[model samples]
Structures are given as C-alpha cells and as structure tokens.
Target: MTNALTITDVRKTYKNGTEALKGVSFGVRGGEMLALLGANGAGKTTLIGILCGLVTKTGGSAEVFGVDIDAHPEQTRSMIGVVPQEFNFNIFERVGDIVIDAAGYYGIPRSVAAPRTETILKRLGLWDKRDAVGRTLSGGMKRRLLIARALVHEPKLLLLDEPSAGVDVELRRGMWEFVVDLNAHGTTIILTTHYLEEAERLCKRVVILKRGVVVQEGEIAELVRASGAKNLEDFYLRV
Candidate 1:
C-alpha cells in the first residue's frame, strides 16, 4: 500500500542560524496512527510546519499520499488537517460560527457545512456549547472545539499536536477514544505528543527525534525490545 505521508532527508534551517530539522526522514502508512515523540525543540513542530506549508524546508522533499508537498502545495494542503498546540479560533466568535467559517474557507458551502458542523460538534460533545463564545468554554471543550474545527473539512491525513495537553484525565481518555474511532474509519493520523503513555497506547509506530535529528524509528514494541527496556519511556530515554 502507498504511504499516507513520506519525507526524504528533510532539512530546515532559519536565517538566524538555527537548525530545526537536520536531514530527518520517515513515512506514515495509510490508515495508521503514528507517534512523533520528542523533547522541547526536537523539531517536531518545525517538521509539522514544513508538512503543513507553514514553514518551508531548505532541502529534501515530502509528499502526502502521492502528491509532492512543495510542488503542489494547495493539493497537499487540501489532503491534510492540522490541529495546532495552541487554540487559534477567534475568542469572541460563537463556537458554531467558527467551524462554519472554516468550512467556508475550504470552499464548502454553508448548506453543506451546517449539518457537518452539527454532526462533528455533537460527536465531539461540543454541540451544547455551540451558542457560547470560544472564550467561555473550558480548556477541554476548547480542545474538542479545535479538533472539531480541524475535522470539519474532512481531510485524509490529520496531524494532532498534543490534543490532550492541559486536559483532565477523564477528558483526555475521551479524546483518545474519539481519535481511535477516527483512525478506525481510515483517517491516517500523525501525533506529536510528550505523553509517553498516550503514545504507547495509541500508536503502532513511533519516531524519536533529538537535536533536530531522528534518533529512532520503528514499531513501538520493536523499539522497546531492541532498547532492552521495559517500555517506551525507557526506550525513549535510551534514544
């Protein structure tokens, strides 16, 4: 089967002499849930940025499904959905309006966006809060809203940047179930997260990055066994 996403010796460096990704590479399979693990400044975000076209890479190449990321940016973007680490919606806007407007930007008409928005919001447990402004929702609700906004357009690949960060355990587990269902339905997901347990639970494959380079990449179980370790945390430390 063709990979959902592929990167070949990807590299990124800023004008200020900061190297974000140093010749790193990996590929995610179609319908797979993969974990991208790293510490702060591990180039996880930069790599995501490069994939999303938010940041440009200085060297190498990447593709979504079979489309070249750089050569067909618009086509590549249309195939991907990104949930950033931060809440990016307008604070004062009604929750439903935010999602509807996003769909409109994607060229989805209001008639089509309406019911999709309703279904997505309800599925994520945000329907009751639709009339409320974004600022009024709790942190977990905000995170669900973020996921809802991302899924409103129904892209093929989803990049979630710490979707459970700052959330309570109950809500975090709920989010996990939702993500699992998403993957089960064939949306290929690549997640960047600090929570090792979450990664261990949800991902079949893992990639470890350190100092802008890929230090390890393999099946989670294989990586743990190869490191002579008990678990992902231990294997990650060895990386």
Candidate 2:
C-alpha cells in the first residue's frame, strides 16, 4: 500500500542560524497511527508545519498520499487536518460557529458544514456545549473543540500535536478513544507527543527525534524488545 505521508531528506533552517530540521525523513502508512516522539526544539513542529504549508523547507521533499507538498500545496493541504498544541479559536465565538466557520476555509458550504459539524461535535462530546463560547469551556473541552475543528472537513491524514497536554488523565483517555476510533476507521494519524504511555498505547510504529535528527524508527514492540527495555520510556532513555 502507498504511504499516507512521505518525507525525504527534509531540511529547514531559520534566518537566525537555527536549523530546525536536518535531513530528516520518515513514512507513515495509510490507516496507520504513528507516534513522533521528541523533546522540546526537536523539529517535530517544524516538520508538521512544512506538511501543512505553514512553514517552508529549505531542502528535500514531502508528499501526502502521492501529492507533492511544495508543487501542489493546496491539494496536499486539503488532504490533511491538524490539531495543534495551542487553542487558536476565537474565545468569544460559539462552539458550533467555530467549527462551521473552519469548514468554510475548505470551501465546504454551510449547508454541508452544519450537519457535519453536528456529527463531529456529538462524537467528540461537545454537542451539549455547542452554544457556549470558547472561553466558557473547560481546558479539556477546549482541547476537544480543537479536534472538532480539525475534523470538520474530514481530511484523509490527521496531525495531532501534543493533543493531550494540559488535559486530565480521564479526559485524555476519552480523547484517546476517540482518536483510536478515527484511526480504526482509516483516518491516517501522525501524533507528536511527550507522553510515552500514550504513544505505546495508540501507535504501531514510533519515530524518536533528537535535535532535528531521527535517532530511532521502528515498530514499537520490536524496538522495546531489541533494546531490552521494559517500555517506551526506558527505550527512549537508552537511545
């Protein structure tokens, strides 16, 4: 099967002499959930930005389901959804309106966006709070709102960046279930997270990055056994 995402010899360098990514590369299979593990300033966000067209790479290439990100940015972006670490919605806007408005960016009509918004909000457990403003919701609810907004257009590949950050354990587990269901339904997912347990639970494959370079990439179980580590945390430390 063709990969859902492909990055080859990708590099990014800021004008201030910071190299965010240095010849990084990876591939994610369709319908697969892959964990991108890294510390702060490990270039994970830069990589995601390149794929989303939010940041440009100085060298190399990226493709989404076979479409080149640089040559066909609009087309590739249409195939991906992103839930960033921060909440970017208008705090004063109604929950339902935020999602519907986001769908409009993809040229999805209100008539189409309305019901799709309803379905997504319901699935993410945000339907009851649909009339509330973003500021009124709890932290976890706000996170769910981000996921709802990202899924409004139902893209083929989903990029989740530190989604469980600041969320309580129970709420995070609930969010994981929803995300697992999404992957089960064939929505390819690439998750960047600091939670090692979350990564082991949800991802079949793992990629560990250190200082903009890939240090390890393999099936989670195999990597753990190969390193003779009890879990991902130990394996990560060993590497």
Candidate 3:
C-alpha cells in the first residue's frame, strides 16, 4: 500500500530555544491506523500541529500521500482532517452550522457541504441536537461534534488528537467502534491517545516518542516481544 503520510528527519524548535521535535521520522501506510504514543511534553502535540500546518517545521520534511505539506499546503489541508485535543469551536455557534461551515474552509460548496454535514452529524448521533448551540452539548456530544466536523469534508486522512479525553467509558468505546468502521471504509487514521489499551486494540503500528525524539517504533506485537514487556503500558513506562 502507498503511504498515507511520510515524515523524514522532521525537526521543530520553539522561539524560547527548546527543541520540541528532534529529527523524528515515521510513515503511516494507506488505510493504516497508527498510534502516536508519548508522555506529556514528548512533542506529540507539536508533531500533530506540524502535520496540520498549525506549527511550522524548522527542518526536514513531511508529506501527505506523496504531496509535500510545505510546498502545497492547500492541497495538504484538502486531503487531511484534524480533530484537535481541545474543543476550539465557538460556543455560541449553532451545532449544525459549526460543522457545515467547516467545509467552507475547504471550498466545498454549501449545497454539497450541507448534506455531508447532516450525514456525519446523524452518524455521530448528534442529529437531534443540530439546532442546539455548541455549548449545550454534553462532553461526549461535544467530542462527537469535533469528529463530525472533521469528517464532513470526506478527507482521506484523519488525525485524531486525544479524541476520547474526558469522555465516559461507554462513550469512548462507542467512538472506538465508530473509528474502526471509518478506517474500514477507507479513511487512514493517526491517533494520539494516553490510553495504552486503546492504542493496542486499535492501531496496527505505533511510534513512541520521548523528549522530542522517536525512542521506539514498530508493530505492536513486535515492540512487546522485543522489549519482553507484558503490554504496551509496561513497555511505555520502560521507555
């Protein structure tokens, strides 16, 4: 399969002289669900930010489906959708409009964006609350709304950043199932989550970061066998 994303010797440094990503490199295969594992301050967020064009890379390269992100930023954005770790939408906006308008950013006409918006909203179980304001949704619904917004444009690559954070157990599991279904239907997914078991269960491959660099990476089973660790969590702590 072709690569959905490729990162080669990618580097990032902040204005304060801190290196947040130090020559990190990895490839996510087409139709692959990859887990980006890291502790806090491990450059996970920075990496995602770079992929989404929210942060600029200081060196090296990143590409989406063979298209260089820096060279063709608009094309990159058109191919990828991101569900950020935080709720960044306007609280006062109508729920449906928040999602529908997101498609406008991609130049999707309102006629096409509206139906797609409704479809994603209903699939995420937020159809009944379409008229409600963003602030009125519960934690789970709010998380679902982020997903709906990401999916409305039918992006081929989806970057989910701590999507289940603050979500209830049942709701989180439901999301897992939904995401699996999404991948099965052809969307490549790169997931960043603090939940080790969730990563083990959902992703085929993983890249673990420590202090802004790739410390370990491989198939889930291979990493476990090589480290002689009982599970991902045990292996994570050791690294």
Report the number of the highest-lDDT candidate: 2
- Under the 3 Å rule for N, CA and C atoms, how many clashes does model 2 have? 0
Local distance difference test, candidate 2? 0.95
Shift of residue 107 alpha carbon in model 1, Å: 1.1
TM value for model 1: 0.98
Ten residues in sequence with the least summed lDDT for candidate 1:
222-231
Write one digit per residue (lDDT tens) for candidate 1, span 1-239: 88999999999999999999999989999999999999999999999999988998999999999899988998999889999999999999999999999999888999999999999999999999999999999999999999999999998999999889999999999899999999999999999988998899999999999989999999999878877999998889877
RMSD per candidate (Å) reads 0.8, 0.8, 0.8
Pick out the ten consecutive residues of candidate 3 with the lowest summed lDDT. Answer: 115-124
Q: For model 2, how does the per-residue alpha-carbon lDDT over 27-76 read when each residue is reduced to its tens digit?
A: 99999999999999999999998899889899999999999998898899
lDDT of 2 at 76: 92
CA shift of 232, model 1, Å: 0.4
TM-scores of all predicted structures: 0.98, 0.98, 0.98
lDDT of each: 0.94, 0.95, 0.94
Q: After superposition, how far is residue 48 of candidate 1 from its true place, in Å?
A: 0.7
lDDT (10s digit) by residue, model 3, range 41-108: 99999999999999999999999999999999999989999999999999999999998899998898
